[model samples]
Target chain A: MTKDDLLIIDALQYVNWNRELFEQAREGGVDAIHVTIAYWENFAEVEANIAQWDRHFEECGDLVMPVRQAEDIDAARAAGKTGIILGFQNCSPVEDDLHNVERLHAMGVRIMQLSYNNQSLLATGCYEDDDAGITRFGREAIKEMNRVGMLIDMSHSAEKSTLQAIEYSQRPIAITHANPSSFHEALRNKSDTVLRALAESGGMLGVSLYPFHLRGGSDCKREDFCQMVYDAANLMGVERVGIGSDLCQNWGYETLEWMRSGKWTFRPDYGEGSAANADWPRQPDWFRDSRDFMNIAEGLRETGFSDEEVRKVMGLNWLEFFRDAFAPASSVGA
Target chain B: MTKDDLLIIDALQYVNWNRELFEQAREGGVDAIHVTIAYWENFAEVEANIAQWDRHFEECGDLVMPVRQAEDIDAARAAGKTGIILGFQNCSPVEDDLHNVERLHAMGVRIMQLSYNNQSLLATGCYEDDDAGITRFGREAIKEMNRVGMLIDMSHSAEKSTLQAIEYSQRPIAITHANPSSFHEALRNKSDTVLRALAESGGMLGVSLYPFHLRGGSDCKREDFCQMVYDAANLMGVERVGIGSDLCQNWGYETLEWMRSGKWTFRPDYGEGSAANADWPRQPDWFRDSRDFMNIAEGLRETGFSDEEVRKVMGLNWLEFFRDAFAPASSVGA
Candidate 1:
C-alpha cells in the first residue's frame, strides 16, 4: 500500500481538542483515534462529555467524525476526517452497573479502562498497595463489555488486575497506552509477563510515546524509542505493537491532577509523578503532537522494520483488533 | 448447658413478620435468627425494607431485638427476645459498588448471597443454563465483604460459583439454606464436592427445611430430615450443619410469584416449581413454623445425636461462626 493507503490509527490520545488539533491529526494522516473522553466521570458526567463531543462533531464535522463501528474508520479515511472512537480511562462511567456497559456502548463509547491510578470498583490501579485483580463487578462488566463490543483497556490497571482481565475477557483486551517495564522500570509500564500474555491472547499493546514512560524521558532518542518498539515486537509479535503516543496535549496541570485524584483521595496524588516534578511531563521532541507520528515510522525503518511490519505496527494492527473489538458478540439465540 | 439454656440460633428464616411469629420463635426458645431482609431489591429498595424492619422492631420491642454482632444474640437471650439478624438473599442491595459493601455492613446487613435464582453480577444462580462462576466484581466484593464482615451465603448459587466462593473467600461462607444434592438431587442443593469444600473451608451448611429442597416434598418425614442432617454432618462435619428454615409465611401466592420472578423475566418463572405446581410448597408437618424448631431437636435425638451435637447443630456452631462473621477486619498499619 502507498503512504496514503497506510491506515494510521493512534490507539490513544487525550487531547483538549479544537479545530487546530483536528487539523494537526488530519495533516498527520491519522485515520482514526481512540480518544479518551472520560476519566473518573460518573455516568451523567460522561453523558455530558458526550454532549460536548456532539457539539465538536457538529462544529468540526469536516475535521472529525464519530466512529461507532470498525467500518466507520474506513468511512473516516475515505472522507479524509479523523475518526474519533470515544473511550474512558476509568470504570467510573459505568458506576456500579454492568447494564451501563451496554448503555455507554450504545452512546458510541468503544473502549474503557478497568482502573486508572487507584483502586476502582472493577480492578486495582497500578498505584495501589495491593493488586486484588478484577473485582466481582469487573468480571461482569468485562462480560457485558465483551457482549456489547466495548474494548477492555488495561492501560493504567495493576499487573494482577490487568493479567486477570486479559484472561477473563472473552475478546482480547487492550493496553491502550503503556510501554514494557522491562524496557523502562516505571510503575505505569507493564511487565514482560503481561506483554507476552497480552500477545498470546491476541491483545494489542499501544506503546506509549509520552516521555514519562520513555527510558530517557523528554530527551528519549528517536532511535532508542524505535529500538524499544523493535525489541517489544520481538517479545510480542509485530502484529500486537502500535503507537498510542498517550498524547495529553493542550491540557492544564489541573486536568492532570483531576485524572490522578478524581475525588478518590483528600490530598493530591501525583500518580507516576513525584513531588519534585508534579505536572504533566513534557512530550518527546519527535512526538509532541499527532502531526509527528510519521517520525516513529521513519525511526522504525531505521531500526530495520520491514515496510509491511511498519505498516502493521503503525495502524493496521489496531485496525485488525478493532474489527473484532467493535462487533457485537454472536448471541447464541438472538 | 441445660435444654432451656442452650443457644438456639436458626441460620435463616424469611417469615412475613407478625407478633405471633415472634411469639412462636420465643415459644420454641429461639435466641437469634438470621432473617433475610432483601431479595432481588436494589439499594434504595433494600433501605425501604430495612425501614420496615425498623418499624417491626419498634412495634415488637418486647418480643424481638436486632442482632448487629455475635454478642447481640446473647443480649436477646438475656432479654427473652428473638434476635433478628438482617441479611440479603442476593447482592442487589450493593448495586455495583464495593463501597456499598462497607455501607451496607454499617447498616447492620451481616449476610448477603452472591446470587439468587438468576445470573447476578457476582455469581450465577443454580437455575442458570451456564454457571460462569464468580465475575470480576464478585472477586472484589468478596475481599470487601471479608474486610467489612458480611457473611456470604451461597444457598442459591450455582455449583461452580459455590465452590469458587468457598475457595476464594478469606472468611468462611455459609450455604445458609440448602440440603445435600446427594440426598434430594434438587437444583438448589449442594453437591458432595461443594459440601466437602464448604466444611473444609470452615463454612457452615444450614440444612434447609424448605419443602421445595426436601427429598419427599411436603410429605418429608421428620425422621428422614434428621437422618439426612446426620448423613450431611457425616459428610460435612457436624459443626458445619444447622437449620435454615426458609419459612415463607403470611404471604399469598402473589408474593411467591414475586420471589420466583422478580422483573427478571417477562413470563412467569416457577424457579424450583413446575407448571402443575406453581404456588408455594407446604412445609413438612414437623417444621410449619418457628414453634416447630424443638421438633427438629427431638428428631435429632431420635436419630442418635447427642445433646451437645443437637445444641451445636441448633445454634452454637453458628455462634462460633458469627464471632468471626461480623467483626470488621483488623486494619494493619492503619
Candidate 2:
C-alpha cells in the first residue's frame, strides 16, 4: 500500500479473532485496529483478558503488534504489521481507586470507556433511562485517565454524562462506535449537540456500522453505512470523523446466547439472559456468509470521499487523538 | 425587625461556635447563616461535625433551627430563630462516589467548596500556584452537585478552575467568601474574568470582608469594602451581588496554626502556618475590635445604593440564586 493510500483504521471492532478476520482487515486496507481486551472484567479478569491476548499474539503475532504509543503505529506500518492497540469498554477493571489507572496504562490498555449501558459508580451508561451524567467517582477516574494519557471512550455513556465527560476530559475523548441520532433517533445514536460538543472539545466522533443503531436498523446496506459516515463528516469536518465498525462477526447461536446474558453483556438492554434469543439474528442477511472486509473500503470509495478523507475515516484521526491524549502532563498549571 | 428590613446572610462563617458567636449573630441581626461542618474530614469525621451541631441544637435549641430548604430561611425569620444551613469549607467528605452527594444533601449539606486552597481530584484550591482549571473529577462533581441541589462554592479554588467550573456547572455556584482581584490582586481575590463567568452562569459573587484580599489589604476600611462590592455590582448587576464574610472570630493563635498546617490548609501559601504567623489581628489597626457588623450596612448606605440594591447585597441575592440552582431540571436530551 502507498503512503497516501486510504489507510482505514477500525477504531472499534469486537469480532472473534481468526486468520479470516485478519485477512479481511488486510484486504480492507485497515492500517491499525483499536481492539478490545476488557468489557465487564475486573482487575484479575481484565488481567486474564490481557493474558489471553498473549496467546493471540503468539498465534497471530505476525498479523498484529501491541501499540502502547502513537509512534508504535508508524513503526507497525514500517514493519508491514497491523498495529493493535488494547482498549477497554468499561472502567470496572480499575474499580474505584485513582492509582489503578496508572497500572492499567502501563499494561498497554490505552483507551477506556467510562460506562457501558447503565449506571456505574463513575457514570451512567447509554442504556440508562435517566442520563444523569458523570458521578464524582467517574470524574476522579477521568482525572486519573487524563493524567496517564489514556483515551476516554464515551460510545456507551448516557447523554448527559457524555456531554459532561467531553467537557471535563481536557484531552480529546472518542465515541469509538456510535451513529448519528439525526439518522435514527435511537438511544445509541448521538444527537447533533453531542457531535458539536465533541468537536469543540477537540475530540472525534467515530461513526459505527452497528446495524442495530443504523437508520435502516438491521437491513442496512454498505451504501447506507457509507451515507451515515458521510453525514457525520458533513456535520463535523472529515478531519474529525472516522470509522468504528463494531463488527461482531464469527459468533454463532450459542455464542450470541452467552453474549446476551448479564454475565456476558456489559449493558442491560442488549441481552435477554441468554444469547440464544431468536431476535439476535436481526443482523442484516447481506452481511451473513461474507468472508471478506474489503467491501468497507470500496463502499467508502463509492461514497466519493477523497483519498485523504478516507484515510482519516479509516484510522488517522484516531491516531492523532491518541498522540495528543497519551502524552504525559507535566506539573503545568495555568 | 420588619420583613422588609435588609437581612444579610453571612453565607460563609467558620467561627468557634459558642454562646458568644451565637449572640453576635443574633445581635448582628443576621437573617441566615451558612455554617461550616466539614474541612479535611473523612466521611466519619464529617459526620461527627454534624453530630456536634445536633447536640448544639439541643443545648441552644431556642437560638437556632436548621434550614434544610430555602423556604426554611423564611421560617427561621418568622419564628425568631437563627437559620443554620449546613455547608462544607472543603469537599473532602463526600470521598469519591457521587452517590454520597445525595446522602450529604439528605443530611442537609446544602453548600460545598470545589477545593480548599490546593488541588483535589475535582478542582484546584485558590491557594495553589498552578491554576489548571477544573479536573475531570471536578467537572463530574459539579454535575452531581447540580443534580442533588448542592451549591458549589469556589471561595478557595484556583483561578482557572474557578473560571472553568463556572462555565461547566449547569447551575450557578457561589463564591461564598472572596474579594475582588481588581482591588488587591491577592490569591484570595478573584479576577474580572472569574466574576464575569460567574455572573454569566446566573451565579452570585459573595464579596467578603476579608481585608487581606481587599484593595488596601489589611489597611482597607469599611468604605473600601463597600466600594469593592459596588464595583462587582456594576459589573454583574445588583441582583447577583451579595456578602460572604470569610469570618473566623472564635479562635486565636492555635486556630491559625492549625489552619496553616497541611491537614487544614489545602494550599501551602494560604497561611504563614499559624494564626500567630498570619497577618493578624485581621483588619487594619483602625478597625480592630470593631464589634459592629452593622458597619457593613452603613457602608452600603454610603455607596448611595437603593434599598433594593442593599437588600440584594445583604441576603436576597443569595436566596434567589439558591432557589434557581436547587430547582429540579426538567429538560433532557441533546
Candidate 3:
C-alpha cells in the first residue's frame, strides 16, 4: 500500500478544535483522533462541552464526523473525513456517579482517564505524593466502564493506580498517551514494569510525542523518537504500541495552566513543565501538528520497521484496539 | 430542671422550610435541627439550595439562625430561636470532589449521608440489590469529612455500607435518621451488628420517627416509640441514642418522588414505601410536625426513663455529639 493508503489515528488530543483544525486533521489523512471532551469539568459542565462539540459537528459536517463505534473510523477513512472520537482526560465528567459512565458513553464519550494530575475519587494522579492505587469507587467505575464500552485511559495516573486499574479491569485498558519512563524519566511516563504488565493484560500504550515526555524535550530528533518507539514495541509487543500524539494545538497559555491546576489549587502547578517554562511545551520541529504523522511513519521506516509494522504502530493497532474496546460487554459478550 | 430547661435537638428534618415551619420549631422548643439541604443535588444545584436558605436567613432572622459551630446550637437555645444546622441526605452535593467537603462546610453544611436510597459512589443505599459496602470514593470522603468536621451520616445506607463506614472513619459517624432493625425490620433500619459497631466506635444513632420506619407505620404509638428508644438505650448505652425525628414536612408528592428516585431511573422508585402506598406516608398522630417534641420527651419519661435519662435521649446526647462532631480535627485534635 502507498503511504497515503494506510489508516492514521491519534489516540489522544485536546485541541482548540474548530473547522480549521478539522481541515488540518483532514490534511493529515487522519482517520480518527480521540479528542478530550472533559478535564476537571463535572457532568453538567462536560455536557455543555459536548453541546459545543455538537455545534462543531454541525458547522464542520463536511470535514469531520463523530465516531460512535470503531466502524465509524473506517467510514471516516472511506469518506475522506476525520472521525472525532470523544474522550476525557479525567473522570470528572462522570464525577462520583458510575451511572454517568454509561450516560457519557451514550453521549459519544468512548475513553476516560480515572484521574488527571491529582488525587481523584477513582485513582491517584502522578503528581500525588502517595499513590493509593485504584479506589473502591475506582473499582466500581472500571466495571461500569467495562460494561458500558468506555476505554479506561490511565495516561496521567500514578503507577500503582494505573497498575491496579489494569489488574482490576475485566477488559484490556489503555494508557492512551504517555511514553516509557525507561526512555524518558518524566513522572507522566510509565515504568517497564507497568509496560510489561499492560501488555500481558492485553492493554495498549500510545507513545506520547508531547515535548516533556521526549528524551530531548522540544529538540528531540525524529530518529531518537522512532528508536524509542521501537524499543517500547520490543518491550511491549508491537500490537500493543501505537501513536497518541498528546497534542494540544491552537491553545494559549491559560489552557495549559487550567490543565496543570484545574480548580484543585489557587496557586500555579507547572506540571511536567517547570515554573520557568510554565506554558505549553513546544513540539519538536519534525512533528509540529497533525500534518506531520507521515514524518513519524517515514522515520519508523528509516528506523528499520517493515511497512506492516509501520501501519500497525501508526494507526492499525489503535483501530483494532478500539474495535474491541468500544463495544458494551453484553453486546460483545466478552 | 424543667423539661423546657433541657437542650432540645432533632438530629434530622427536611421541612419545605418557610417562616411557618420556623415558627413551628419555636413552638416545639427545638433548639437545633440538622435540616436536610440536599438529597440528589449536584454541587451547583445544592449551591442553589444554600442560596435559598441564605434568603431564609435574611428574611426569617427572627425565627432562626445558621449554626456554624456546635456552640451555635447553645446560642440558639439561649436566644430562644431554632438553629438550622444544614445537612445532606446523600453525598451528591459534594459529587466527586473531596475539596467540596470543606467548601460545603464553609457554607454551613455539617452532616452528609454517603448515599440516599440507591447505590452511590460512597456506599450502597437501603434500596439497592447488593450492598458493596464503602466504595473507594467513600473512604476518601470519610477522611475529608473527618478533617473538615462534617458528620458522616449513614441513615439511608445499607447495613454493610454503614458498618464499613463506621469501621473506616477515624471519627464517629451518625445514623442521623434510622431506627434499629430489631425494633422494626425495615431495610432502612440498622442491624444489631451495626448498632453495636456504631456505639463501640463512639458513634450516635438517631432513632427515626418517620412513620414508615416506625413499628406500626402511621398508627405507631408514642409509648411504643419511647419503648423502642428505651430498649435501644438499654441495648446500647443511653448516651449513644437520641431522637432524629425524620420529619419531612410541607412538600408535595413530587418532592417524595424526587427523594425516592432522583434521575437514577426513568421509571419510578417508591423507596421504602410500596407502589400501593407510594406517596409520602403520613406522620403518626402523636408526632405530626416540629411542634411535637414535648410528646416524645413525655413518652420517654413514661417509658421508665428518669428525667436525666429522658434529657439524654431527647437532645442532650446530640448536643454533646454535635459539640464534638462539628469541630475540625485540627481544632479538636481528637
Candidate 4:
C-alpha cells in the first residue's frame, strides 16, 4: 500500500492548536486526525474550545481543514492537507446537558466519551469504585448521541458502562485509544470481555500508544505499542481493530497536573472566555518530550505487520469505521 | 413561664435579615438565633453575607447582638437584645480549602452543613446516590472545623459519610435540623440508627418543621411536627431533642426553584455567586401561610408538652448542647 492508501488517522490528540501545530500535522502525513478539545470542562468551556477551533480554521485554513463528512478524508488527502475531526477526552464540557450534543456536533465535535476518569452525571469514570454501568442520564446521552450519529467513545469509561454502551447504542460504538487489559493490567486498560463484547456489536477498539498500556510504563519501546494491537486482534478480529495513538504531540507534563486537579486553574471559576489560564495548559511529565509521528510509524513496522495490515492499522480501519458509524446529515436520528 | 424563660433559639434559619426580622425576633422573644448567612457559596460570597450581617448590626443594633458564646445568650437576654449566631447551609463557599474554615469561623460562621442537596468537593449531599461518605478533603475539613469550634452539621450529609464523620470528629456534631427516617423514609430524613448514634456522642438532633418529614411526603400541621419530635424524644430522650426549624422565612418559591435546579437563578451557570438576585427572596409555599413563633409554642402546649418541657424544646436544650459541643475560645482541638 502506498502512503495515500495508508491514511494515518490518529483518533486522539490534545495539542495546543496553533499555526505551528496545524502546519506540523500537514507535514506529519496525518491524513486525518480526531483532535480532543474538551476534558473536565463544562458546556461553556467546550463552546470556548470550539470558538478557538473557529479561530484555527480562519487562521490556518491553508494547512488544516475541518472534516464534517467521511468523504472529506479523501479531499484533505488529495489536497495534501490534514483533516481535523474534533473529539472530546471527556463529556464534562457538556456536563448535564444532553441537548448540547447536537450543538457541539454542529460545532464539529464528532466523537464524545461518556465520562472521564471519575463519576460524572452520566456514566461512572473508570477510576470510580462503583461501575454500575450507564446512569439514567448516561443512557439518555447515548440515545441523543446515537440519534445525532455522533461516535460514542468508551476509552476512559468504567468497564460496566463500556459494555452497556456498546450494547445500548444502536450504532457501532468505539473503545477509542485503549489497550487490552489482558495484555498489560492497568486502570486505563480494557479487559478482553469488554473488547470482545464491543467487537460483537460491530464496534471498534483502537489500540492506544500510551506507554502505560505497554509492558513498562514510560520505558516502553514502540514495538510494545504494536504488540498490544496484536493482542486485541487475537481476541477481536483485525477489522474491528484500529490505531488511536492517544497522541498529545505538542502537549507536555503540566497538562496531566491540570487534568488531576478538579479545577483547571487555581483561580478559574469558569473556563469560558479565556483560552484557559496560564496555570492551566501546563505540560505534564509524560509529554514533556514526545515521540514524533515518523517514529510511531516505524515502530509499527518493526512489530511484524505487513504493509497491507499496517495500512488498515494506521488509518484505513478508522476511516471505514467512521463512514459506517456516522450516518448522513439527513439520515441523522436526532 | 415568662418570655425570658422560653429562651427560643432558632438553630437554623436563612432569612433575608433586615431590621424588620430583627425587630420581629425581639418581639417574638427569640433569645438567640443561628442565622444562615452562607449556602451554595464561596469565601467571597460568605464575605458578602457577613457584610450584609454587618449592615444588619448597624441597622438594628438596639435589638440584635452577635452571639459568640453560650454566655452571649444570657448576656443578650439581660441586655434585651437578640443574639445572632451566624451559620452556613452549605460549605461550598469555602470550596476545597481547609484554611477558609478558620476565616469563616473568625467571620462568625458557627454552623456548616457538609453540602447542600448534592455533592461538593468535600462531601456528598443527601440527594446524591453514592454514599462514598466523607472525601479526603471532607476529612481535612472536619478536622479544621473541629479546630475552629464551628459546628459540623450533617443535616443534609450522605448517611455513609455522616456516620464516618461522627466517628472521625474529636468534637460532637449536630444534625442541626432533620427528621427521623422512622417518621419519613426519605433521603432527607436520617435513619433511627444515625439519630440514636448522634445522641450517643452527647450531640443533639434538631427536628425540622418542614412538612416533607412529619407524615411522609404529605403536608403536615404544627401537631404533626410536635409528634415527630415526641417520637425523637421517645428514642433519643428529651435532652438531646431540640428545634431546628429550617425556617426559610421570606425566601420564596423562586428561591426553591433556584435551589432545585442546583443554580441560584434560572440562567445557566447562575451558581458561583452568593447573594440571591434582587428579584429573588420571595416567600415559599410552606412559609406563605405558616404560623408564627407563638403559634409553634402553642402547638407544643396543645401536644401535651408542659411549660417546663416547652423551655427545653424551644431553645434551652439546643443552647446547652452547643455550649458543650463547641470548643471554648482557647482549646479548640485540631
Could you say which candidate leads in TM-score?
4
Across A1-334, the per-residue lDDT of candidate 3 in tens digits comes to 4548679999998899887888888888888999998888888889999999899989999999999999999998988899999999998877655688888999999999998877666777787655657765577788889998999999999898889989999999999999999889998999999999999999999989999999999999999999999999999999999999999999989888888767645457788887788888889999999998999999999998899999999999999999989988998897
What TM-score quantifies how close candidate 1 is to the native fold? 0.68
TM-score of each: 0.68, 0.52, 0.70, 0.76
Q: Which candidate is the best by DockQ?
A: 4
What is the full ranking by DockQ, best candidate first?
A: 4, 3, 1, 2
Q: Provide interface RMSD per model, one decimal.
A: 8.8, 11.9, 7.8, 6.5
Stretches of candidate 3 above 4 Å error?
A: A14-29, A43-82, A89-91, A94-334, B1-5, B119-144, B158-170, B328-330
Q: Against the true two-chain complex, what DockQ does each candidate achieve?
A: 0.06, 0.02, 0.08, 0.09
Docking class of 1: incorrect
lDDT tens digits, residues B262-290, model 1? 64443567788888999888889888888
The Cα error of candidate 4 at residue B285, in Å, is 14
lDDT of 2 by residue, A129-179 (tens): 444456545666787788777889998887888998998887778998888
**Best to worst by TM-score, what's the order?**
4, 3, 1, 2
When 1 and 3 are scored with lDDT, the better candidate is: 3
Candidate 4 CAPRI-style tier: incorrect
